[model samples]
Every structure is written in C-alpha cells, then in structure tokens.
Target: MGRRHYILPDCQIRPGDPTDHLDWIAADIIRRKPDVIVCIGDFFDFPSLSSYSTPGGVEKEGARIKADLDAGHAGLERLMAPIHAERERLRTGHRKRWEPRLIYTFGNHEERIDRPAKEDARFQGVLGTHLCEVERFGFERYEFLVPVEVDGVWYSHYWQSSHSPRPIGGTVDNRLNKLGFSFVAGHEQGLRYTNRPLPNGKTLHGLVAGSCYLVTEGYRGPQASNEWRGVVVLNDVRDGNMAIPMSLDLQYLCREYAGEELQAYMDKRYPDKDWSHLA
Candidate 1:
C-alpha cells in the first residue's frame, strides 16, 4: 500500500476554528491511518503583528500578542489531540512497526515571532520564541521556507525557488508551470488544483490547499470568494497524484464521523446555546 498524508494548510488559529471539522477528520485519519499528517502552515494568526493591526502605533501590543498566542496554543491542542492519540495507539499496541507522525509547517504569520527579536536587542530572547519549540504538540516542525517531502509531493509555506525566474506566485497553476513538480502550500486562501499528464501514464498535480477559519478581512474583497476553508486529503500519494480540498461542514462532519461526541466537550463548557456554528 502507498503512503497516505492529510494536508491541512493555513489554519490561522486566533479566535480559531471549530474542533468539529478537525474532529471529524481525526476520525477519518484514524481510519485512513496515514503514515504522515501535515498541518501545512500558518497554524497561528498573530494579528497583533499585522501592519493593519497597529496602523498608527503599537497599543497594548503585548496583550494582543499574548491573547493570540493563548488561543493558538489551545487550538493547537484541540487539533492535535485525536491524531496524537491514534498515533500513540498504533505504535504502542497493534502496529508496532507503524510510526505515524504529525508535521507542522511554519507559515509567515507564525513567523511573526521572529520580528520582535529582529527589531529589539534586550528583548530578543525574552519572548515570542515558542515557535522553535514543538515538543509539546508532538509535531515535527519545518520553517516557512523549508520544504518537507512525503512520498513525492513537497509541502512548503510558499513556492519561489531561486532556480526559477523570480516568483510565479502562489496559485497552483503558477507553481505547476514554474516548478514542474508537485507542491502543496498555504498563505493563499481558497482551494485550487492543476493536473498535468506525464508520458508514463502518470498524472502530476499541485494544490493550493487553502485555509480553515472564521476570521475574514475586508481586504479579501467584499464577497471573499477568493478565500476558502477546508483540508486536503491525499491517499496513496506518489508522483503528485492528489486530492482536491474538500470543503468541510464541521458540524455535519462531527455528527457523522466523529467517534466521540464532540458535543460532550461543548455541553460542559456551554450548557446552553447551540455551538453548531463554532469557528
């Protein structure tokens, strides 16, 4: 059997996304039982660092950063819990040889941690360095530019190789035409795919596996159709054969796929109110 990998890109965790979508995928991940799962990038949205955030000057910047970090941390735990459990169960019991791994790619937003250190000297080592530490999350981490390879496809935050002209941009078609290889990345929202036929009866593919979150910006156009929310799943991935991002309905998914009642977690916290619209 070929290796399977689930590509979840750009989950800009701040106010965060509903656990239901991730919960549902965790169930499927348990079943598909992929050898690797890639949380492709920008898992955290450091809103405080945005130029738009502090247009005039930095106000309560520390507080804003802390809040984003806190939410991001909590969101990370929720997203990783089921995958962690399944991975451990497989290694500890029935499948001793199976070594399932969780891979997290640091996108530009997550890189917001570095800017503080770059600008200030005394505060360089003081804070915003947690991106370097991934042990708690049980994930193998990669920087924004470092590409992680699966069976064949490469996962990176963005694609603009020095070998190429300049930057062909982040669109799937642009990447496929420029790099002549399969790639999956985030930073740009919305699901886009490009498939090219090879001479060997094989199909090469590239995917812009978009973001999953509730936050929307006015800058992303009034309708915001350019952005998308979902995860990409690749089964038997080899030589770039890929799956398009499947738009998710976390509520419906949790109801149908989640092995455990996600509502149980919500019920205790929010005794009243239907949280079907979470994220």
Candidate 2:
C-alpha cells in the first residue's frame, strides 16, 4: 500500500574470524523481516583465488587456500541457511504477500575476480555458485549498479555527474535535487542523506547505505582513522517520499567476532607502513 522498506547490509564478509559476520547479519535480517535485502558488495573479502598468495607470488600450493575458501563457504551457508529456511517458512502460508527478495551488486574486491588469468577461476567459481544460490532464493543480481524505483523514486549504486570534483557528495540535496527522483546508493561505507530545495519549491532526497562489517586492518595512513561500519533501513520509499535521515546504525558485528588472533594476523601481514589513506 506504500513504499516498501528494504534492508541493506554492507560488506558482510571478509577474511576475518571463524565466526563469520554473515551468519550474524543473516540472523538479524530474518528476525527483523524486511521486504528485501540488498548487499552493497565486498560480501567476500578476496573474491579471486589469485589474491591469496605469498609475497613471492607463489600461490597456496595445495588445499590450504581451498580449505580456507571452503571454511568461508561453510560460514556463509550457516548464515544464509536461516534466511532460506525462513523464506520457505513464510512462503507456505502467504505465497502472494511474502515473496522476499535478495539483491547483490559487485564491489571493487569482487572486480578482481574478473581479472586476467586462471587464478581468477576460483573467484568466478565461487561467485557463480553464490549467484545460483541467490537465484534459488528468488533474489536478483545486478552488475556494478542498477536503477530501482521505490515509491516513484529512482535508485542506483553509482551516480553520474559532470563535475570533476569528488565523485560522491555527502548530501543528497546536491546530487538529486533537480533530478526529479529519490536516490539511494552504497559503496562509501557511511550513512548519509541530504534534502535540497528544488527550483519548483519542493525538495530532493538522497541516501547512502553504509557498511555492516569491520574496516580491514590493512588500512593505514590518513584513512586509518576513518573506519566505520553499519547497516541501513529504508523505512518508507514507496509512497513517493524519502525516509527522513535514512535509518542506519553503526555496529561492530564483524570486529567483535574477528577475535584477537585474526586481527594480529592481519596486522602482521599488512603492516602499518603499507597502509593507504583512501578507502
């Protein structure tokens, strides 16, 4: 009857603790039971098998990488199992009213999967399997970005602009005020929204869905202090209106489960000397 609320969770997975943040987020999503779930990308840390290698460029010789990948898969399954189960649980009764959907978009890390070489095979295989699983659950997948309409508002993962300045402006007011559509996007890993006055005496609204996982320890330099993660809830968008402030909360779900061992390992592998200032 009105704008449907969509729950978007960002960067659900990474090479972190054995606990797996996806499992936690999945459980939380099922409990909250939103109309749809969208993943902003980087759902998997190293989307390509080639990325897992020693500094000498030697790949993991045997089952070491596979084992780790398998472990990651198992963790994802554990997290998604409930979502799949709940879909079935809800489908049996109100097949028409409750057809939950899952949507995924590619992130920079995942782009590595499409890189040149046989090593990318692992990434292709893993993502292919994930796509199939998502389809089985009646979810849709978009490439880098796709436009969506909610309550007459248009949304996309990336926005186009002629200005040569920063790609993303913190406020929606400057981005979509005159575009005549409400917009939502994710990739910046921070929650932001802006409402700007239009020439027609109305206002334009924009929203940025934030991340839900921990900031990778490999990050250093000026950007080292800018780490944050969280999930977003689009309360109302179907009634031709934008949700005020665009609900979001910062929670260290992944960091909490990462455990000290993993953190130490990451710190050792990617020393602060190699950290970068950009996210």
Candidate 3:
C-alpha cells in the first residue's frame, strides 16, 4: 500500500506568539492518520540566541533562553496533545494504536544553541540541543542542515550547495536541477515546488516550504510577511517519487479545524495588531 507523508514546515514557535496552529495541525493529523509525519525544522525560534543580532544588544534585550525553551516545550505539547488523547482513547477501546513515524530536522534557528556554546566554554554544558528534549516527544532529531531520507525521498532543513556552506539559492527548478533527486525541505519562507522526469519515466520532486505559524516577524516588515504558510501532504509516495502534493494552508486548516475563518480568528485573538498581510 502507498504511504502518506505529512510535511510541517518551520513553525518558528517562540515566546509571545500564538500556538493554536499546533492544535489545528494535531487535529488534522488525528483525522488523517498519515503513515509518516515530518517536521521540516525551526520548530523553535531561539531569538535569545540569534546570531543575526549582537548578543546583549538592544535587539537581544529582554529575550530569555528559558522563556524561549519553555514556549517551545508548551507548543510541542499542544501539538502532541490531540494525538496523545487519540492514542489513549484507542487503547481504552482496545483498538489498534495509530502511531506514525515522527521526524524532526534541526533548522538554522535551532543551531543557535550550539554556535555560542561552541565558541564559549562557559555555555558548553548549559546551552545544548538536549535542553529541548525532542527525543522525549518520540521524534528522531537530526542535526542542523543534515538530510534524512524516508521512503526514497531526501528530507533536510535545507539542502546546501556542494561547494559552499550556504543553501542552494534560486528557484525550485534550480534546486531540483542541482540536487537531481526527490527531496523535501524547509528554510526559505513560502512554498516553491518543481519536478523533473527521468529517462526511465520516473519523476523527481522538490519542495521548499517554510513559515507555518500565524505570527509575522518584524524583520519581514509588512509586505514580505504575506508569504504562504501551512503544511504539505504527499500521497502515493514510493521510491523517492510522489504524485502531485496537496497544500494545506493556514486559512484552510483554521477554517476546518478551528471552525473560524483565519481573518476572524486573528481579529478576535489579536485585535491590537494589524494582520492585513496575513489575509
């Protein structure tokens, strides 16, 4: 039987951001019961350890590592709550448990924990990826930028160029041409997909989707914040091949699971801010 793969892009869960989207995703997962679920990384946005800004600078002020970790833990628990509840219900009723493989790739944001720690001996033991405790959540954790292949498809936070440390830049077609394989990744914001056919008629697919959360970053400003946000579902996947993928955008997920249109939900929940870009 063909397997279904659910790909959740970078949630970027951090302190002060709403995490109801995680619950929405969990509800959808409970209903779909996909064979495999992949979190394409950046589940935690460690702004406290962000390298983009100077440490102890104005941008880094008021950002606490503990607060950031706590938020991530809470968000992750919310994401798993519905699934855990469903599993418990199944066990009580003596039904087969719906257990899917959970895979999490570490993104550049998660790498923040290591960089400062590696440079300064004082942070060595205190600051580490182990603090997040992803393994406890039944997720197979991968290092930043490392690729993990499942069902013949390569999955990574983002695929880097063979010659450089930077990610393979340009269009999805460029990535497909460079990698020359079926792969799914998350890092760049928004969604970009392309496929190529082989001589033997098999096709290779490439997907790049990030930004799964409802909040927009100040850095993105108003215009750039309007990028696509949501999860992806791949059906009939085998041998690193896939049929056309399905996009489950935030609006669709919220409307179906939350029973409210995304705009209305945002307005009622976060009325103080302008969420026009998200519309």
Candidate 4:
C-alpha cells in the first residue's frame, strides 16, 4: 500500500491586498495530492469580533461590528476562493477513491471570540452561525480535537493536558510516548522545534507541525530570532513503517511566488518598518 502524507499549513490570513502565495500553496497541494490537509489554526487573522447591546433596545454596536465582520469575511472569501475550489474538486474526485479528511483547530485568536460569548447563548449562537459560513466556504473543516487513524497511526490537533500533579508521563514528550502515536499541534507560531525519536528501544515518535504564515509585526521587531515561516509535511511510510519530515521553505516560496507584489503590499501597510530582509 502507498504511504499516507499529511500536510499541515498554518494560514493566519490577515486583511491585505490578497497575495498570490495563497493560490500557489493551494496549487502545490493539488499537485502533491496528499492524503489529508490539516490547517494548524488561525486561518483568519481577525475575522471574528465581539459586541454588546445597549439598554435602549438598539444593537448599534452589534450592527457595526457585524458589518466589519461581513467585510472581512468577503475579503477572505475572495482570497481563499481558489483554495476552496481545489478542495471541492478533491472532495468530489475522491468520493469513490478515498474519503480524506480536512481538519481545522481553533487557535488562541479564535478562542477569544468564544470566551465572551460563552455566557450568552444568543451571542454563542451568532458565533456558531458565522463559523458555519467559514466551514461552508471550505476555509476549515474539523474543530476541536479531531482524531484520525491513517495506516494505523492516530493524530490530534491538541495533545490532551495531563492530569497528574507530578505526572511521569505528563510532559509533552512523555505523553506522546505513552500514547504510542504521532501527535501534531500548532498553537505556537513558527518552526522552532520538532522531536522525532526512533521507536527502537525508545518509546514513540512525535512530530510538531510548524506555522506557515508570516510572523506578526510585533514578533518581527525586537523579539525577532529564528522566526522562520514554513509548514511541515509528514510522510506516513506504510511499506517501511516510518515517518519522514519535509519542511516547505515558505520564505523562498513567498518570495518566488509572491514576488514584488507582496513586498509592495507590506511596504504600503508598514511604511515605517523594513521587511527587505525577508526573502
């Protein structure tokens, strides 16, 4: 049997001039034809908002916020249209071939939208409605901890937090070993670390999918060091029973595919800053 490959791309899409990198990435995916596509999180940089109603029975603030969200949603849809089209084509073509799953986990930004609305059911209902629209457009698929078994290997967006106080198998490394399966998470943006020990006399194999989007301006200024943007492709080798790691050089791809347009957009957006160092 052929191996199953999982592509994890972190797309923190912010309001911008709609770069072509998004389309290139989608086209690359269609060309590669992976077994599954997993969006790490933060698909829409700030597509959600919170608002309050006044005692005067007028939803003035709510209406304005909704308008802003609608605009952002429209912009994102335009930017993501090609990717959505590819996803639909894959879904239709693979209907009889194999039902590959699309998974999306909520990042810290999305969590903020859910926090305030947790108390008000009506607000939560509205949030759900918007999320449904996001899903309908194929921007995301699964939310929360979605489990999948590919060639007898299990995967989840979030590793379950350990309960033990001085837990022996509670640490990220230990928990993964105990689970005897590969784990992937994306809360942390950037490709800082990834540990994958052999399953010889040791415990288990662990892989951390890195972020695919550009670092924030704040993260780029003073705290900038090893802030590389890229995605991870995990190859589940069935014939040999191995997992190979391949890092997609997003920096180069962004430059090659996006070219001067992206630079111009960034320059116009951040006139004071200089991202000329980015290649």
Number of the top-ranking candidate, with lDDT as the measure: 3
- Each prediction's whole-model lDDT (CA): 0.68, 0.53, 0.89, 0.53
Q: Provide the clash count, candidate 4.
A: 0
lDDT of 1 by residue, 1-279 (tens): 566787777777764334445656667667666788788778787777775565545542454677877778877777668777866787788685545677888888887887788789866776554643665887887876788888778888877667763335755676787778777777777777778888987777888765775444545655553355666677677656755434443334555674435455455555664434332
**Runs off by more than 4 Å, candidate 3:** none
Question: Which residue pairs collide in model 1, if any?
Answer: none
Per-residue lDDT value at 196 in model 1: 84
**What does candidate 3's lDDT look like per residue over 60-179, in tens digits?**
889998999999889889998788788889989999878889998999888888886899999888888888888878899998987898999999999999999999999999999998
| TM-score of model 4 vs. true structure | 0.67
lDDT of 2 at 38: 65
**Which residue ranges in model 4 land beyond 4 Å of their true spot?**
4-6, 17-19, 47-80, 83-100, 129-132, 138-140, 164-175, 192-203, 215-220, 237-242, 255-273, 276-279
Of 1 and 3, the candidate ahead on lDDT is 3
Task: Give the C-alpha miss distance for residue 199 in model 4, angstroms.
Answer: 6.0
Which ranking of candidates, highest lDDT first? 3, 1, 2, 4
Off by over 4 Å in 1: 15-20, 55-63, 90-98, 161-167, 225-227, 242-255, 258-279
Pairs in steric clash, model 3:
152-240
